[model samples]
Target chain A: MRRFVRQAAEILRGDPAADRVVPPTGITARLTLFTAAAMAFLAVFALALSLAAGRLADRWSEELARGATLRVSAPAGEMEQQLAAALRVLETTPGVTEVQPLTDDEQRALLEPWFGPDLPLESLPVPRLITFQETGGGYDPDGLRLRLQAEVPGAVLDDHRRWRRPLLAAASGLRVMGWSALALIFGALGAMVSLAANASLAANAQVISVLRLVGATDDYIAAAFVRRFTLRAVAGAALGTAVGLAAVALMPDTGDTGGVLTGLGFRGLHWLWPLLVPLLAGAVAFLATRIATTSVLGDLP
Target chain B: MDLVITFDNVAYSYGGGELLTGVSLDIAPGSFHFLTGPSGAGKTTFLRLCYAALQPTAGEVRLFDRPAQELGRDGIAAIRQRIGVVHQDCRFLDHLSVADNVALPLTVAGRDGPAARRDLDDLLGWVGLSKRADARPPELSGGERQRAALARAVIVSPDAILADEPTGNVDWEMSQRLLQLLVEFNRMGRAVIVATHDLGLVRVAKKQVPARVLRIANRQVTAAGADL
Candidate 1:
C-alpha cells in the first residue's frame, strides 16, 4: 500500500523526460480533452438540477406541513349549516390557530387550472374548502374527525398528504434523477478516458518497448501516460466548469418555486460543489490510464 | 557474482518449435566475447535471455548471479538498468533528438539531472555525434544512428553491454570504430558481448582484444575451434 501511494505521488509530481516519451499529438489526446470538457459541462447542469429540485422539495415540505384543508359537501339546504358547524368545531380545536373558509370566487380560481376560469360556483354542488393554519403543536385529525362526524356529518378532513406526498415525492424524484445524471456523466468520463488510454498505449508500443529496453519499469511507462491524460482532463474539466457556471449565472431567476428560472443556479456555499468536477475528472483519468497502461504493458516482453 | 550472466542447461521454444535446447554458458565479468551464428540460430534469443527479456522454457538463466525467475518484473527492470542492450534496428524514440536518445538510459533510470547531462554530452562527443545532438533519430544517417545507439547503451555506465549487430548498417571504417569503443569498454572492466553475423569483424576484434567466439549452428551454441 505504501509503495502504491509513493508511486502515485511520484507520477503526480511528474518527470518531464518520462512525459516526453509519449508523442504529444494523437487522436487520444484531443479526444480525452474534448470528452472531459463535454462531460463536465453536462455534469454541471445536472448538479444545478439536483440543487434546484432539493430546494423545491424543502420549500414545498415546509409549506405543506404547516396547514391543511377541510372540505364540506352537503345538500343545498344544509350546506351553510355544515360549513358553520365545521368552522365552529375547528375554532374550538386545540392547536388550530386560524380558520378561514375560501370564498366562491377564490374556489373558482383554485379550480381554474383544471376546470377552467369559468367554473360555475353558482350551479354546481361543489364542496366548500376551508383552509386552516396550525400552531407548532398541530391539531389531532382523529379528534376533529370524530366531532365533525357527529355534528356536521358532511364535513371531510383532509390532512393534505394526498397531494403533498406526490408533490414532495416528485421533487425528491427530480433530485434523484439529477444525481443519477451526474453519476452517469462521470461514468462516461471514466469509460472514454479508459478507451483513450488504451489506444494511446497501443499506438506507442514501440516507444514502450524502447523504454523497457532502456530500463524503464511498467510504473514509469504507466506514469507517463497517466500524467498526460490526467492533466489534460483537469484542464478540460476546468474550462467546462467555468463555462457551465457562467451559463448558469446568466439564467433568469423568475419564479419563487424551483427550476432553472429560480433556484437552479447555486447559492452561497453550494457553488463550491461543482468545483469538484475537475478533481474528480483528473482522478478518473488517473485510474483509467493506470489500468490501461498496466494491462497493455503486461502483454509486452 | 563471479559471472555477469550464467545459463544452466537453458532451453527455449517458440512458435511450436524448440529454438534452443540444453544451452549452458558463462559470461564472466570484464570479459570480451563474440557470438556468431546463422540467421535461424538462436543468437537474438540468447542475448534476450542474458538480459532477462525472456524466461527460459527449461532450466535457469541467472543475471548478476540472481536467478532470473526469482527477480520479479520490477526486480528484473532494476537488473536491466545494470545491463545495456543495443539492438540491430537501434530501437529509439524517433521523436527524441540524438542527444536525448543517447541520454535515454539515464532518463529511464530516473537520473536526468545535470550530472547525467554532462555524461550525455561526453558520450556524444566520444561517438562523434556531438554535432548531430539536436537531430532526431530519423534525421541521422546510418553511421550516426549506430553511434547514437552505442552512446545510449553506455550512457548509464552499465556493468555489461550487449550488442546485436551494432555495426550492421555501417561501413568497415565505422564498424572498426564501434568495435574499438566496445573494446575500450571491455578494457574498463565492463563485460562486452557482441552478437553479429560478420566473421571478419570478429577476426579483426580477436587481433586487438583477447576474445572468444561462440558459434550457434544447430539448436546449441559451442565455442568456435580456434582463435579467430
Candidate 2:
C-alpha cells in the first residue's frame, strides 16, 4: 500500500501538466472531448426514451386494465334499449365504480380519423358503446358476461384484455430497446477510449521505452495514460451532461394530442439519472485505457 | 560491495537469428571492465543480459544469485533500481526538461521529491550540466547528452553500472571526461561495465585504473587479458 501510494505520487509529480489544468492540446484531447459530448447528447435521448416508455407502460397497464367497454349490437329498434339495459346492470353490479355512455359526438370524434368529420351514423350499423370503470376489486368477467347476456341479449362485454395486453407488451418492449441502446452507447464509449489510448501509446512509444528503461514499471506507465484519459473523459462528460440536461429541460411537455408524439423529455428524477452518464463514461474510459495500456506495455521489454 | 552478475554458457537469439552463444563471464564488485567488439558482436545484447533486460535462451544468467527468468517484472525492476544503464542512443522523453529526465530514475524508485530536488542540483553540477538542467534532451549536444546519461546512471549510487557505447556520439575530450567519471564511480566501489569499440579509450584508461578488456567474436566471450 505504501509503495502504491508512492508510485501514484510519483506519477503525478513526473508530469508538469499533471494537475496543471491547462487547455487541452493535441488531437487526442480534442477528439476525446468531441466524442464525449456527442455521446452525452445521445445518452440524454436514450434516458428520456427509457423513462417515458417505463411510465407509459405502467400508466397504460394500470388505467386501461381497470376499464372495460360494453358494445350493444342489436337490430335497429333495440340498440338503445340494449345499451341502456347493459348500463343499468353495470351500474348496479358489485365492484362497478362508474358507467358512462358515449355521446354521439364523442363516438363521431373517435371515428373521425377513419370515417370522416361527419360520420353517417344512421346509415351504418354501428354498435352503441358504454364504458365501464371499476374500483380496486374489479367485476368478475364471467359473472358480468352472464348477467349482461341474461339481462340484455345483444350486449357484449370487453374487459380491455385484448387491447391492454398488446399495448402493455409493446410499451415494455420499447423500454427494453431503450435500455439496450444505452448499453450500446456505453460500449461505444469504451471502444472510442480504447482507440484513443492505443493511438496515444503508439505516439509516445519512445517516451514509454525511456521511462521503462529508467526503472518505471508497466503499472507506472499505464497509470499515466489511464489518468490522463480518465480525466479527459470526466471533464468532457461533465460538459456534455450539462448541455444535454439543459436541452432535455427545454423540451415542451404538451399533453397528448390524439396519438400525436409528445412528452419526449425527462420528468421528475429522470433528469438526475442522466447525471450518472458522465461518471459511467469516465469509468469506461478508465477501464478501457488501462486494459489497452497494460496489454501494449506488456508486450514491451 | 559484491559481485552482482555472472554469465555461464548463455545463448541468446532474436527472430531465430543467433546473436550471442557460448558466452561465459563474471563481473566482480567494484571492478570496471571495457567490452570492445565489432559492430555485430552483440555488445548491447550482452549488456542487456547483465541488467536482466533479456534472458538467455540456454545456460544461466545469475543476477545477485537469482536466475533471470525467476525474477518477475517487479523483481527485475527492483534489481534495475540498483543497476543503472546508459543506452548507446542516449534516449530521453523529448517532452520533459533535462532536470526531469535526470530525476526520472529517482521518481521511478519512489524517492522523496524534496531530496531529489536538492540532490538534482548537485548531480547537474557534477556533470557540468547545471545551466542546461532546464533544457530538453534534444537541445543538448552529443557530449552533453552522454554526461547526462552518466549522471542518470550513478544518481542512485547503484551497485553496478552498465553502459553501451557511452561515448559513441561525443568528442575525445568529452569521452575522456566520461571515462574519468566512470573511474570515479569505480573508486567509490561500484562495478562498471562499458561496451564500446573505441580502442583509444581502452589505452587511455590503462594509465589511470586497473581495467580488463572483453571481446565478443564468433558468438563467444573471450578476455583480451591486455589493457590495450
Candidate 3:
C-alpha cells in the first residue's frame, strides 16, 4: 500500500523531460481517447440494464409468491354456488387474508389485450378467477387444494409455483447477461489501451534510447507513458459517463406502472454508481500501460 | 588513484561473430586515455561495455568495483549517473532547446533547480553556446551539437567521461576546441577516455595533456607507438 501511494504521488509529480522524450503521435492519442469513451458509454447502459433487471426479478418473486388464485368452472346455473363455496372455505383457512371474486368487467379488461374490447364475456364459458391475498405465513397450497377439492368440487387452487419459478429464473438470467456484457466492455477497453500504448512505445524507439542513454531508469520512462495514458482515459470516460447519465435521465417515466423499458435507469442513490466508470478506466489504463512499458523496456538494453 | 572501470579478458560478439576478444583495460581517476582503432574494430562496443550498456560475452566488466552483471536495473542507472558518455551520433531530444539538451543529465537525475540552471548557463558559455540556449538541436551545426553533447556529459560533474568519435563530423578547428574541453575536464581530476581513428587528433591531445594512446585491430587492443 505504501508503494502504491508513492507510485501515485510520482505520477502526479510531472516530469517535463520525460514528456519531451516521446513526441506526441496524434493518431494514437485520438484513438485511445475515442476507444475509452465508446467503451464507457456502453458500460453505463449495461450497468443500468443489470440493475433494472434485478429490481424486476425481486418484484416479480415477492408479489407472485405472496398470493394464490382459485379458478371455478361450472355450468351457468351452478357457477355462483361454486364461487361462494370456495370463498367460504378460504375465510376459515389459516393465514388467508381477503378473498375477492373478479367482476365481469375486470375479467374482460384482463383479456382485452388478447381478445380486443369486443369480447362477449357473458356468452363465453370462461371460469371465474378468485384471487386471495395472504398475510403472515401464507396458507399451505396443498392443504387448501385438498379442502377446495372436497368442498367445491370444481375449484382449482394455484399457488403460482410452476409459472412463477420460471419467470423469476428468466429475469435473473437477464440480469446476469447484462453484467456479463459489462465485463466484456471492460475487457475490450483494456485491450484497446494496451494496443495504443504498444504503438506509441514502438514509434518512440529513438526517444526511449536517448532516455536510457542518459541514465533514466525504466520506472521513470514507464511512469511518463503511464501517466499520460491514464489521464486520457479518465478524461474520456468522464465525458462518456456524463453523456450516458443524461441519456438515461431523458428516458420516459412510466410512473408506478412502468414495465421493463421505462424502468431501465438508475434509481435514487444508484445514480452515483456510474461515477466509478472513470475511475475504473483510469486504473485499467494505468495497469495496461505499465505492463506494456515495462515489457518493452526490458527488451531494450 | 582509484580505478573507475576494469575489464578482465572481456570478449563481445554479435550474431555468433566475435567483434572484440581477450581485451583487458583499466580506467583510473584523473587519467586521460585515447582509444584509436579502425572503423569496425569495436571501439564503440568497448565504450558501451565500460558504461554497462552491453555485457561482455565471456569475461567480466566492472564499474566502480562492482561487476556489471550483478547490478540491478536501478543500480546500473545509479552507476551510469557517475559516468558521462558522448556518442558519435550526438543524440539529442530534438524538441528540446540547447539549454534543456545540455542540462538533460541533471534533469534525469532529479537535480534540476536554480543552482543547476546557473551551472547550465556556465557550461553553455564554456561550450561557446551561451547565445544559442533557446535554439533547438535541429537548428545547430554539427560542431554545435557535439559541443552540446559534451556539455550534457559534464553537467553532472561525473567522475569519468567517454567520447566515441567526438571529432568525426566536425572541422579541424572545432575538433581542437572539443579536445581542449575534454583536457580541461581531465585537469579537474576526472578520468577521460576518447575513441577516435584520427592519429592527428591523438597527437594534438598528447601535446595538450599527459595521455595514453591505445589501438584496436583484428579483435585485439594494444598500446600504439609514439611514431604517430
Candidate 4:
C-alpha cells in the first residue's frame, strides 16, 4: 500500500524532464479527449436507460401479478344481476382484499383517450369490469374462474397472465439491451484510447530512443504517457458527465407524461451512479496506455 | 583496474551480412582508447556492443562481469547508468533546455534534487554552457550541442564513456576543446572509448594521455602505429 501511494505520488508529480522528452502531438491529444468525453456522455444515457427499465419491469410485474380484473357480459337486462353475483363471488374468494365494480364515470374516463371525452356508454352493450385487489398470495385464478362459472355464467377471470408475461419480458429485454449498450460504450472508449496512445508512441519514437539511451527504464518512460492520457480521460469524462446529467435533468418529468420516454432518468440514490463514468474512463485509459507503451518499448533495444 | 566490459570472439550480423567478426577486447577502468576506422567500418557497432545495446550473434559479451544476455531489462538499465554513451548525432530532447538535457541521466535514476542541481550547474560551468543553460538543443550551436552531450555523458560519473564521432560536426577549435574535456575525464580515472575518423584528434589525444588507437578494417580490429 505504501509503495502504491508512492507510485501514485510519482504519477501525480511527474518528472518534467521525462515528460519533455516526448513532444506533444496536438491532434492525438485532442482526439483522445474528445473521444473520452463523447463515450462518457453515451455511457450516462445507457446507465440511466438500464436503471429505468429495471424499475419499469419490476413495477409492471409486481402490480400486475398482485391484482386481477373480472369482466361480466350478458343481455342488457341481465348484466346488472351478473355483475352483482360476480362481485359477491370475488368478495368471498380467499386472498381477495377489495372488490369494487367500475362506475360508469370511471369506465368512461378510461375510454376517453380513445373515444373522446363524450363516450356513449348507454348506447353500447359494454361489459362490466370488477376490479379486485389482492393480499397475501392473491386469489387463485383457476379456483375463482370455477366458482364464477358456477354462479355467474357470463363472468370471465383475467389474471392478466397473457399481457403481463409479454410486457414483463419486453421490459427485462430492454434492461439487458441498455446494459449491453453501456458495455459497448466502454469497449469503444478502450479502443480509441489504445489507438491514440499507439499513435503518440509512434510519433515520439525518437524521444523514446533518447530516453532509453539515457538509461531511463521502460516503466519510467511509460508512466509519463499513462499519466497524461489518464488525466485527460478523467477531465474529459468529468465534463461530459456533468453535461449528460444536465440534459437528463432537463428532460420532461416522468410525473407529467407518465410515459416510458420521459422515464429515462435516475431516482434517489441512483443519481450517484453516473459519477463512476469518469473513474471508469480514467482506468480504461490508464490500462490501455500502459499496455501499449510497455509493448512498444519492449520491442525496442 | 577492474574490467568494465569484455567482448570474447563476438560477431554481429545485419540483414544476413556479418559486420563484426572474431572481435575480442576488454575495457579496463581508467583506460583511454580511440577507435578509428574508414566509413562503413563497425566502430559504432562495437560501441553499441560494449553498452549492451546489441547482443552478439555468436560468442559472448559481458558488462561489469555479467553476461549481456543474462541481464534483465532493469539490469541492462542499471548497467547503462554505469556506462555513458555519446552518439555522433548528439541526440538531445529538442524540447528540453540544455540543463534538463544534461541532467537527464540523474533524472532517469531518480537522483534529481538540490545536490544534483548543484552538480549540474558545476558541470555546465565546466563545459562553458552555464550561460546557455536555458537554451534548447536546436537553439544551441553545433559546438554547444556537443558540449551539452559531453556534459550529459559525464554527469553520472560512469565507470566508462563511449563517444561515437563526438567531433564529427564541430570545427577544429571545438574538436580540441572536446578532446581536452575527454582527456580531463581520463585523468579522473574513468575509462573512455572514442570512435572517430579524425586521426589528427587521435594523435592529439595520444600526446596528452597514454591512449591506444585501434583501427577497424576488413571486419576486424587491429592496433595502428603512430605513423598511420
Candidate 5:
C-alpha cells in the first residue's frame, strides 16, 4: 500500500521535459480522452443503479420479513369472534409485537379504490385484517398457523413470503446486472486506452529511437508517453463524471413512489464514489502506456 | 582507466557476410583522431561499435573497461552519457525547439537544473545558435542543424565526442569554425573522433592539433603514415 501511494505521488509530480518529447497533437490523444470520458459517463449511471438496487433489496428483506397480516373471513357472527381470538393468540406469542385490528374506517379506505366509497358495509360479509410486527428473529409462521387453526378456524396468516420472494429476487437480479454493467464499462475502458496507447507508441517510434540515441533510458522514454496519456485520461474522465452527475441529478424523482426508474442517482455519501473515476482512469492509462512502451522499446536496438 | 574505448581483434558481420574483421585499437583520453576511408568502407559501423550500438561478431569491445555485450540496457545508457554521438543524419526530435533539443542529454540524465540551463545557453551561443534557439529543427538549414547537433553533443560535457561528418554540410569557413570548436574541446581534455571523407579537413586539423589520422581499408583499420 505504501509503495502504491508513492507511485501515485510520483505520477502526479509532472515531468515537463519528458512530456515535451512527444508531439502535442495526434489521433491517439483524442481517442484516449474520448474513450475514457465515455466509459466513465456510463460507469456513473451503472454505479448509481447498483446502489439503488442494493438499497431496495435491503428494504424488502428487512421490512417485509418482520411484518405480517392476519385476514379473518366467516359469517358476521363468527368473524368478530375469530379476529378477537387471533389477536389474543398473537399478543401471547413470543416474537409478535404491536398487534392491532383495523377499524371500519381503515378497511373502508383500503377498499375505496376497488369498491365504491358509498358501498353498504353492513349488508355484506367482509374479512377483518389484523396487522402486527415481529421481533428481529421473527415468529414461526407454521406455529402461528397451527394455533389459529385450533382456536380461530376462519383466521389465515400472511407472513408476506408470497409478496416478498419475487420482489427480493428481482431486486437482487437488478443489482447483479448493474454491477455487471459497471465491470464491463471498466473493462472496455482498459481495452480502449490500451489501443490508443499502442497507436501512439507506434506513431512515435522514430522519436523514441532519437531519444534512446540521446542517452535516454527506458524509464525516461516511457515517462514521456505515459505521463501525457494519463493526464489526458484524468482530465477527460473528470469532465465525463461531472456531466454524468448532472444528468443523474436532473432525472425526475417522484419521491418514495418512483421505485426503480426515477430514483437513479447518488444519495448522501455515495456521491463520493464517482469522484474516483478520474483517478482510476489515470491509473488505467498509465498501465496501458507503460506496457505498450516496454514491449516496443524491447524490440528496438 | 586511461583508455576510453578498446577493440581486441573485433569482427562485425551482418546478413551472413563480414563487413569488418581483425580490427584492434585503443582510444586514450583527450586524444583527437580522424577516420577517413571510401564511401562504403564501414566508417559509421566502426563508430557504432565504439558506442556499444552494435556488438562485434567475434572478440571483445570494452567500453569504460566493461565488455560491451555484458552490460545491460541501463549500462549501455550510462556509457552513452559519457560518450556523446553526433549522428550523420543530424537526428533531432523535430517537435522540440533547438534549445530543448540541445539540452536532450541533460534532460535525460536528470541534471536539468539552473547550472545545466546556463551551460545549455552558453553552448548554444558558442555554436552561434543563440538566435535560432526557439526555432525547430525542420526550420534550420544544413549548417545550422550540424552546429545544433554539435552543441547537443557537448552540452552534457561528455568525456568523449564521436562526430560523423561534422562539417559535411558547411562551407570552407564554417567547416574551419567547426574544426576549431572540436580542437578547443580536445585542448580541454576530451577525446574527439571525427569520421569524414574530406582529407582536406584532416590536413587542416593536423596543423591546429596533434590529430592522428586513421584509414579503414581491406576490412581493417590502420594508421595512415603521415599521408595528408
Candidate 6:
C-alpha cells in the first residue's frame, strides 16, 4: 500500500504546466485533442443508439406479448354474425378478460389512411376488427385460431407473436450491433490515442535523450508525457461529452407514446452512463502514453 | 571496500562495429581516475557502461557486485541513483532554471530532503555560477552549462561521479575549478571517472591530486607512461 501511494505521488510530482512549456506548440497538441474529441463524440452516439435499441426491444416485446388481435371477414350479411361468434369464442377462452368489436365507424377510421374517407362500409366487403385482452395465463394462440376457423370460417386470430417475435429479434440484434459499434469505437479511440502518444514521444526525442543523460529513469520521463496526454484527453472528452449530452437533451422527448426518433435521448438514470466516457477515455490515454513513452525510452541509451 | 564497478573482457560493438573489445577493468570505491583518449576511441561509450546505461555486447559489467546487463529497469534505476553523470554536451532541461536543473536528481529520486537556497547558492558559487542560477541552459555560456551539470551530478551525494569531457568547453581557470570540485568530492569518498582528450589538463591535475590516467587506444585501455 505504501509503495502504491509512493508511486502515485511520484507520478503526480511534476508540474505539467512547467514541463509542457518546452514541447513546441501547435501540431502535436492539435492532433491529440482532435482525436480525443472525435472519439468522445462517437462514443456518445453509440451509447444513445444502444440504449434506444434496448428500450425499443423492451417496449415492443412487452406490449405485443400480452395482447392478441382478432379480424372477421364475412359476407356483408354475415360480418356482424362472424364478429359476434369470434367475441363469444374469446369470452369463453380461459385467460380472456375483455373483448370488444370495432364499430363501423372505427373500421372505416382504420382504413381511412389507404382508402377514401367516403367509403360506404355497409355495402363494401370490409373486415371487422376486435381486440382481446389476456389475463395472467394467456390463451393458447393455436387453439384459439383453430376454434375461430371452425366456428367463424372468415375470422382470423393474430396473437401478435409472429410479428412481435421478428420485430423484437431485430431490435435485439440492433442492440447488439449498437453495443458492438461502441466497442469498436473504444478500440479505435485507444489505437488513435496510442498513435498520437507515439508521435508525441518521437517529437520529443531530444527532451527524452537529455533527461536520460541527467539520470532520469524511463518512468520519470514517461510520467511527464502520460500526465500531459491524459489531462488533455480528459479535458477534451469533457468538452465532447457536454456537447453530446446537450444535443441529446435538445432532441424531442417522445415519451412512451412518442415515435422512435423523438425518444432518442436518455431515459431515467441513463444520463449517468455517458459521464463514464470521459473517465474511460482518460484512462486509455494514460495507458497509451505510458506504453509509448516507455517503449521509446527503452530503445534509448 | 565495495567494488563500485568492474568490466571483465567486455566487448561492445554498435551494430557489429567494435568500439571497445577485450577490455577488463575495475573502479574501486572513492578512487579518482582520468580516462584519456583520442577522438573516436569510445570514451563516452565506456562511461555509459559504468552506470549500466549501455550493456556490453559480450562479457560482463558488474556494478556493486551485480552484473550490469542483469539489472532490470528498476535495478538500473537504483544503480543510477547511486551515480551522477555529466555529459560533454552538458545537457539540461532547457526550460528549467539552473537551480531547478541542479535539483533534478533529488526531484527524480523522490527525496524529501530540502533543496535549501543556501545549498544551491553555495554549490553554484563553488562552480563560479552562482550569479547564473536563475538562468536557463540556453541562456548560459558553455562553461556555465558544464558547471550546472557538475552541480546536478554532486547534488545527490552519489557513491560515484562519472563525467565525460566535463571541461571540453571551459578555459584553463574554469577547468581547474571543475577539477578541484571533483577532487573535493573524491576527498569526501566518492569515486570519480572523467573521460577527456586533454592531456594538458591531465598533466595539470596530476600535481594537486593523485589521479590514475588510463588511455583508450585500439579498443583497449592502457596506462599512461611513467614519465608523466
**Candidate 3 docking classification:** medium
Model 5 lDDT vs. the true structure?
A: 0.87
TM-score of each: 0.91, 0.88, 0.92, 0.92, 0.92, 0.90
Evaluate every candidate with DockQ and list the scores: 0.78, 0.43, 0.62, 0.67, 0.75, 0.48
TM-score of chain B of each: 0.97, 0.96, 0.98, 0.98, 0.98, 0.95
Superpose all Cα atoms of candidate 4 onto the true structure and report the RMSD in Å to 1 decimal: 2.8
Query: What TM-score does prediction 1 earn?
Result: 0.91
Of the true interface contacts, each candidate retains a share of: 0.84, 0.56, 0.54, 0.68, 0.72, 0.36
The digit string of per-residue lDDT tens for model 1 on A143-209 reads: 9999999998998998877878998999999999999999899888999999998888878889988
Which prediction has more favorable lDDT, 2 or 3? 3
Q: Root-mean-square deviation of each candidate, in angstroms?
A: 3.0, 4.0, 2.7, 2.8, 2.4, 3.0
Docking class of 1: medium
The clash count of every prediction, one per candidate, is 0, 0, 0, 0, 0, 0
Instruction: List ranges where model 6 is wrong by over 4 Å.
Output: A1-25, A76-81, A114-125, A254-258, B112-118
Which prediction has the highest DockQ against the true structure? 1
Candidate 2 root-mean-square deviation in Å: 4.0
DockQ of 3: 0.62
Best by TM-score: 5
Q: What docking tier does model 6 reach? A: acceptable
lDDT of 2 at A205: 84
Expressed as tens digits, the lDDT of each residue in A1-301 for candidate 5 is 5544544465689877777888876677888788888988998899899988988888888889788999988898777777788899999888999998999888888899999797577777888899999987778889999999999888989999999999999999999999999878877887787778778878888888778777888877877777888898998899889999999989987766667667777778999999988988888877777777778888888
| Segments of candidate 1 deviating more than 4 angstroms | A1-4, A72-130, A133-140, A257-263
Model 2 chain A: weakest 10-residue lDDT segment is A16-25
Clashing pairs in 1: none
lDDT of each: 0.88, 0.83, 0.88, 0.89, 0.87, 0.81
lDDT (tens digit, per residue) of candidate 6 on A93-203: 888877888887887888899887887888788788888778988778788878888898898888888899898988888789878987887778778778887887877
Q: How many Å off is the CA of A255 in candidate 3?
A: 3.8
